[model samples]
Target chain A: MNHKEETIRVVNLETGYNSKKGATVITRGINASLYSGELTCLLGPNGAGKSTLLKTLTAFLSPIKGEIFIEQKPLREYSDAELSKVIGVVLTEKLSLNNMSVEELVGMGRSPYTGFWGRMNENDRMIVDESITLVGIENLKGRMIQTLSDGERQKVMIAKALAQETPIIFLDEPTAFLDYPSKVEIMQLLQRLAREKGKTVFLSTHDLELALQIADKVWLLDKPHGVTIGTPEDLALNDDMSRYFYREGVEFDRESGLFKISHKLDQAVRLIGEGARYNMVKKALARQGIDVVDADDCDVEIETTDNCYIMNGKEVPSIEMLLDMLNLYCK
Target chain B: MNRKTTMLLMLLLCLSIMAFLILNLLLGTVKIPVKDVIDILLGNDVDNRIWTNIVMKSRLPQSLTAAMAGAGLAVSGLLMQTVFRNPLAGPSVLGISSGASLGVACVVLLSGSIGGVALSKLGVIGEVTITLSAIIGSLIIMGLIAFVAQKVKGNVTLLIMGVMIGYIANAIIGVLKFFSAEEDIRAYVIWGLGSFSRVSGGQTTVFIVLMLILLPIAFFLIKTLNLLLLGDSYARNLGLSIKRARLLVIGCSGVLVAVVTAYCGPIVFLGLAVPHICRGLFHTSNHATILPASLLGGASLALLCNLIARLPGFEGALPVNSVTALVGAPVVMWVLFNKRKNEI
Candidate 1:
């Protein structure tokens, strides 16, 4: 642990939508400290106010009460240009850039730092190029943004944020529409960004498995109340997980550290082997529903068979043939 | 192009515009060479009084009107497109032009019927009625569109609503046309055909002043517009007052559209087509470049259309709108058909 103080602090924050009547409070009294160089996943079920909280935290919505601080300064105190230098954002909305090339789109990340006319100088170009290379989309630099795939577009967006060179990055459901592999890749990239580059990444996601596997800390947005923030193991051990996710006959298996249906019964499998092959054989035997027993106590003979099954010095290529041989011997 | 190159191109464009204006003044129904045109401009012309009157009064003001109208419509289109984040959005989409047309229709068709006794009693009131009605109609439609824009979240929906409003306004114009007399109908038809020659030297000053007021507002709102391109939430995240910014942009665009409508009688295509052409030419949507580029491009395109309209062989000048449509429609169509598949 770096033992550094928290970089993002939210104290008693209340947020919601506003209407003619008054404010509609979605959730209240959320308190959390997001630390430096940490990958924090905001986890919650659908309609649990995860997005609202993320929006509030990112200053997209004004909190009716309490305060948010970045680097010990009040979030609202910073000008847009000043704040953009400290925090970068990746929104969920899709952008349309018809004539703009990928590099130009990425270059827009430096907007906050650019002059009044928004001209890009040599240093700005270098940063854009480097960010493009960092996101591993250098090959698509010349291509139009509208030509990129969804996953590729997401990466380019991330590259754009990276080009901003902000210390903290906030993403709103970046993996929402990505396939499983792409989702995993994005999570891994985020982890690498936090660990290697010392950047703090805060993202909202419903992908609990990926969050549990990758995040340094998890903030679960429980319904009708505030959020719970801790390590993934801490939340799991405290049994706070069930409150966020509810499905009939489904439960978290503490021992295996995975989710399983409560109605499912375990079918035991036994195998005899010494090292690497032991687990492989166990898995193969588990698929067949046959138990592998110890050699001394087993009634069945064990041998390495090639091209045919040989038991007690008899060769039988087919199961029927082996059964007939056994009946003949018994008679 | 590089910054220097773009700057140089803009300069060349300005120079060419000046040259075209001079040429338009010199060569018209009666042939006056370039030297006589320059000499007339300098107040030292040894020419026929009729020729001087034509050069000084009609041709000069007409050319200036064409340039100003072109620039105004183009800037309005550019601003509308940026604010709405739609390539297809224009001043016409919001029925501002139709509003002007409706005003003209009422003047030509309903004036005699609505205020026959008043017209006979007060002739000045009749002329004032027409201009005021047109200005009021444009303002009313602008107000409606601005209200709708505040309510609507999606750009595409706003665009569709604008088109519907235009259709409804045109329907009202259709009804007015049914009651109009042939002479009145001819006057309205000629206005509908569009003309820069209608603006006198005095009106040109008003046009320039209105543009001067509106262009700065557009420039001042550039930062907010850039934030807006990222969408509302993102803009809010950046601490931009989105509602305020939207109002400012809408107000600016309304003024631009209204001024052009008041003067040029809803000249077509410049507002709808020039912005896209400028965007394509500049290869960037950043308003810093696009705004000025659209202005120059609009000026050039308008001058070209005006020149084509006044080509010597034609018995009378072709409709300015017809010339612009012939040039502009193809370019806009190409943009629509060949647009990249992944654009929103």
Candidate 2:
């Protein structure tokens, strides 16, 4: 792992919007320092001020009261053009551009570095190419933005931000609309970028499980607790995850580092077989309010092999027969 | 689009513009040959004095006005659409032109009550007053929109507010028409019909020169417009001052529409439709391509319409609005229809 360097430091920052009625502060008096070579996930439930914090950090919204330093320089002291070189941002809003190819869109990231006419030179083109390859989106470079799937479009946007050549990147819900595999891939890509390029990759997302899996550091935020920064394992072990995310029927599983629904199992079943089939049966029964217990004395016992399931001592050909026997006997 | 394809398309558009401009000069009510038109353009004395005077004084200025008005309106439309991120957005759609019309209606319809003199009786001075009032009315509305834009976050809300303002302006114009005398109403109606021929000689020179200065300035906004297409959040995060960019673009577009409407009386459809034609033709939304393409496309379309308006059968009496609307509407429809298959 590369040696870490502090990139962004926040001291007693209050973040939110100023409305017509009054100052509406979302998170207040927060202090945190984001480091290079770290993938920090800003995890929070909806309306937990994650976006507000991000907007404030990126200087889109003014900090209500406090100091934010980028590269140890006060953020407010840097002009917009200067700040743009220090921090790049990938917003959640869909680009309304049409007939523009991915390469053209990504090239727009060089706006701050370009001259008054905003023309791209050889070095800018090289940076754009490097960014496109960094995001592994070279194939989509020539494709129109409108033709891209949601996942592809998200990658293109990340490439655009990468092309900005900033040391720090802020993304708001980068995986919001992607499919399962795409979500995992995007999270992994961000983590890899942070580690390999020594970039501070800060992103806000609702994908708690994925973030826990890949995030080097997690910023747990909620309405009550402004923000708690730590490693995912540390937060889990310290019970801060449960404190912020736990509800009536939802429980945080420390073993798996995931949140699972905690519902009462009405009946217990014994599964005698092992491996994937047994686990599959156990999961299916668990969803139907049946618990798979290791106790050997249970009345209902399910044994699985390959594609076959046996109920008690009778062999059942498929999972349907096993489910039928359980429904008949468990009641 | 690649550089070659874009360059080729621009070349084609320029050729079309030249062809249409020459056609506009040659194919008017008076049957002037191509040879005479060229000679007059080259500053050589022509065989006939009437032909010389007609080509140099009247047709030349009228064609130049149409070209400038067309280019200015098209560029304004492109700016408005990009700023609002709406395909339907145009200079007229923002009520700026209706504001201009309302100003003219006030001067022409309520002349006797306001100044104790009819506008028709004032002659040359009355024309100047009418143009000034039109510019002032449109500027007031533009200022109001700019103020609202500073406070509002969403572009859609601003667009809807602009449409409502247009409706309110038209309603006031209707009320003014209801109370006006028949002759006054007729004069206002004629102005509302729109014309490129109204600007002639020295006035045409001033109009074209002003547009020449303004249109190139609009091109300087190409970078800003491209950034705007990324939408507000990205634009802001990319170091754009959203409010300042919005105000500058809106102010530029508003002034363009105001000046064009002041002179040509709210020549509709061309401003609303020419940008779409350029987009469809180039298949790209990059302002670098769209801006110049729209200028050439607008000028060509305007010249074509002007040619049809001055056909021998119409006796140079047809309103340019009728020609523009009749031609521009179908082109807009076709572009929209084609855009459904592709993306904007």
Candidate 3:
């Protein structure tokens, strides 16, 4: 009921499902806070209870421990309509709408604010149209939702959330089915929403790279039932990323800013190129047990004179010829 | 469609429905001129007593019954479709109609030996007994479907469960038929043919009153129904109690189906087909328009079928169910096929 500087505060939250056998605790003793004008990405592996936590926060499910407060008041204290006015959720499931224009579907976002008849007044229409333009789907406003592609559908879904005019929006895997480009676009849209609209945007994503690139703060769910919340760079610099994705062979390389797996290759190969093409060739060579070295390295040599070439006192013609020359010279 | 054009079309549809009702009153096995039919309806003393009896007793109730059954069935269908979130869902699909049929079969075919009086004795007591039994049967089946619908989240699974329930009701009806006497069986068979004329003047009042009570409840729940189309979780997020909304929808739909069946003997296809037509006409899923549109559409379609059922020069009136299937099946098929191609 109190709306003083609205924020989502979670204290010592423990969430998981239980059966007769025992409780399978996901995340325990978690304390987190999300405020306006920020985009928070909840990053974790599959089955790490990211969705469970999101659902609990949205009041879809109750947590086993601690309480969540929106605007310093307990979440349970707010009625469903009141909560809806504050929190708008975008789920990963497909909506069950057919033959409805983009405008009509987006208008449903204003349902909580509408009267019992669900009629859209002029203000409601303006909000819906503004949401469509916010998502940059104004041209497709008249198109049927069924005809839109997955990426477009996702944008429309977000637009629907925006139409709700809620201060806090929670999206579960907003880019789950989108390609790399679409993923970046969606994340950027969420970022813009947070920054420009002064709304709090919370999303769970498996796209770790995109999340790291765009999120203002990352809620990293790691093993041993712990979570670390900070800026993406802060989490990366603190080496928290390694703990979250702890597998046997894979390692997070801080220098390359990417994940790498240990390889058992004996030979290294030299290649000539620059930029993305060179990186692509290096990756291709790595898969074949041939690591790429810079062309300027002194230890590597290029035999140009195929019919009469010598390198390190060895003559080579073709690659086959080089093999023959190495065989003869070694003998 | 533009708003004005759509409103105009709807008005014209209403007019056509009214015209069909007038035609149904005038034409029968013994033909009467349009002028005399109008005069008789205005309470004029006519020379032909038989004509008056036929028009007032047989023709008038038949037409009104058809319209009511149509409206009731169509609204029932619309509610089922929206609640289940499946376009194919209807009273027949959920076995509610079959339950009503089973109740009728039992009372008319099997319960005659208990007393000298038949089930269709045409009194307050007989009518009340039949109506209550039908309602009880429909409620039982509706309750079962509602229970399963909650547990199983998928629309396909829910539809399959409804069909299975209908099959079970049919099996029970077959068993009851097997045990019934020849005369009682004949009577049940005639009822199974389905006619709107079975509803007398007394039954018409009961039918209208029940409809008035139930239809408004459906309209009042339109907001919840609209939220439901977004799915349960979304509805919950919108502050609707999902369980309560589902119960209300099922209860209202059950009452609609039960009353129509009790009086009209399972008028088929209207409930299954009319909502799709309404949706097609309106081109919107918002229940604010779709619900009332479906009610009026259903009433109109029923009146149309009633007029067709009593086409002049026929030896006897065609079964109302047969007429509805003839008309409704094609519309349903078109909706299904069109949706498949368009991926709606």
Residue A303 C-alpha lDDT in model 3: 36
Ranking by TM-score: 2, 3, 1
Over all chains combined, what TM-score does candidate 1 have?
0.82
Location of the lowest summed lDDT over 10 successive residues in candidate 2 chain A:
A322-331
Cα error, residue B57 of model 1, in Å, equals 2.1
The worst-scoring run of ten residues by lDDT in candidate 1 chain B lies at: B117-126
The fraction of reference interface contacts (C-alpha pairs within 8 A across chains A and B) present in each candidate is: 0.25, 0.61, 0.52
What's the TM for model 3? 0.88
Q: Which segments of model 3 are wrong by more than 4 Å? A: A1-6, A18-24, A247-251, A260-265, A269-284, A292-331, B121-128, B143-168, B341-344
Clashes in each model (backbone N, CA, C under 3 Å)?
0, 0, 1
Q: fnat, candidate 3?
A: 0.52
Scored by DockQ, the top model is 2
> What stretches of model 2 exceed 4 Å from their correct place?
A305-307, B338-343
lDDT of 3 by residue, B71-190 (tens): 888888999998888887887788888888778777776677656567666566766777677777877888888898678756678778888989998998888778777777776777
In model 2, residue pairs whose N, Cα or C atoms come closer than 3 Å (at least 3 residues apart or on different chains), thus clashing, are: none
Question: Positional deviation of B195 in candidate 2, in angstroms?
Answer: 0.6
lDDT of 3: 0.80
